[model samples]
Structure formats: C-alpha cells, structure tokens
Target: MADGAGRRVDPDVDLRVPRDRREVAAHPAAVLGAIAAGGVLGALARAGLQAAFPHGPATFAWATFGVNVSGCLLIGVLMAVLRAAGGGPPLARPFLGVGVLGGFTTFSTYAVDVHAALVAGAPATALAYLAATVVGALFAVWAGDTLTGRLLSRGAR
Candidate 1:
C-alpha cells in the first residue's frame, strides 16, 4: 500500500499492528529525548526575542508576530524537505518539526497580546494584529513550501 504522498508502506512496520510495549518504548525514547533537547533550545530563543523586544499592551507585539510567522515558514520548509526526502532521520521530525517549532510558536502569547490590546482601548490594533498575524503566517508558510519544493525539484532534475 502507498501513503498519501505515494510512498510505499511497509506492512511489517505498520503501527496499526500490535507490537511489544518494550519494543515501542525503546525506540521512541531517543526521539523523545531529541524533542526535549530541541524544545529547550527553541524556547530559549523565543524567550530571548521576547526579552529583547518587550512590548506593552498599548504597543504592537512585533516580536510575537515575527516568531509565529517565521516559525510557520520554517515548518513549511521542513515539511517540504521531509516529504521530498520521504522523511529524514527518525528523530528529525520529532526534534525540529515538532519540538522546536512547537516550542517557538506562541499561540498563548498571541492571544494575550490581543487581549491586552483590547483592554488597553486599542480594539482596532488588536483586530489588525490578529488578522495580520494569521494572514502573514499563512502566506509565509505557503511561500516557504513552494520555494523549498521548487528548489528541491530542480535539484532532483
């Protein structure tokens, strides 16, 4: 059978098939460790950015916007590379794609920023920021995906 990307599926290695608990735990431990390490790095980077560009309720949160948009873009590129390569090292997805990006993107912070803006009598700014962040992140992700896919396709040729 083939997956959504048309990659051949190995039935023997399928997750749907029941496996020994020990076997599953042993392999996933390393991937979890990689994710934990990557998460630390990603979170620290995000914290540094937030610290350097601290914004108040009345001010626009440029730092959070940049982080979320850039994270989205990088995720798009990462996904493209992983797909193009039929997936990379086992830990690569868990580490970079999940742990790093997950840690870096701040949905909770975004929500708080919007709430703060509204509370500070900047409803327009809050609405604008919300719209811009969502639209910008979507566009960035699309651009990253297209660009990476094209580059990889050309390299393949």
Candidate 2:
C-alpha cells in the first residue's frame, strides 16, 4: 500500500515505527507485564497518599483531588513529550500512560467520595468536589500540554 505522500506502506508494520525500519511488534505478554508492574507502583503510591491524608465524608477529599489533578497534568506532559519525540518504546505508553496514570487517578474513588459526601448530608460539598475535580483536571491537562509544547518548541529552535 501507498501512503498519501506516495510512499510505500507495509500494512503489517506498526505505525509507531518509521517506514524504513523493520517493524518490531511488542509481545503481548511484555505489554501486559509492563502495565501490571506500573499499576502496582501507581496503586501503592495512591494508597499511601490516601492513608496519609484520610478525609471524612463530610470534608473535602484533598488526597484524591491532588492525585487526579497531578495525574492529569503528568499524562498531558507525557503525551506531549512522546509526540514531540516521535514516540518511544512500545511499552512506554502502556506502562506509564495507561497503567500508571490510569491506576493513580481514581474516578471510581472520586465517585465514592462524592456519594459519601452526599450521604453524609453534604450535597453542597459533593457538588463542589465534583465540579472542582472535573474542571481542575481539565485545566491541569491543558496547562501541562501547553507548557510542554512551548518548552519543546523552544528547545527545537
């Protein structure tokens, strides 16, 4: 097959690889292993944070909020760097992005925290936490992406 620029393309080749090189597909086991290892570390870190800063249902879930926001920011930065660097090893995204960040950021816990707040007769706190987390995460991602892009572009020049 030929790409839009009229270069020959191998259908079996991993798109992440340059066309001039032989495509080396990552073994499924390796990918899964990376994810699992990263997940363990991420989950442990999150658990430690939660344990260190336990919060009642009626109060703000600062630990979860911090973890989620930082995770979002890290993901944005990681993605930008990966794109700018033309990607990385096949295991990089699976290990760091999906596994680690996915594990570290707890949407399920966020939901539970919100539910607990509501159940504790703190509807206003629940609503506030929900809005803050969503908005803060979005803004953090945007900030990280923008900052990384700018820095990378400057270094390129």
TM-score (all chains, Cα) for each model: 0.85, 0.84
The local distance difference test score of model 1 is 0.78
The alpha-carbon lDDT assigned to residue 110 of candidate 2 equals 98
Clashing pairs in 2: none
Instruction: Spell out the clash pairs found in candidate 1.
Output: none
**Residue range with the least summed lDDT across 10 consecutive positions in model 1:** 3-12
**CA lDDT of 121 in candidate 2?**
100
Error of 1 at 118 (Å): 0.6
Lowest summed lDDT over 10 consecutive residues: which window, candidate 2? Answer: 3-12
Best by TM-score: 1
lDDT of 1 by residue, 87-119 (tens): 656667668876788788889999999999999
Badly placed stretches (over 4 Å) of model 2 are: 1-26
Kindly list the per-residue Cα lDDT of model 2 for residues 46-118, writing each as its tens digit: 9999999999989999999999999989988886776676555556766887678888888899999999999
Once superposed on the true structure, which residue ranges of model 1 sit more than 4 Å away at CA?
1-26
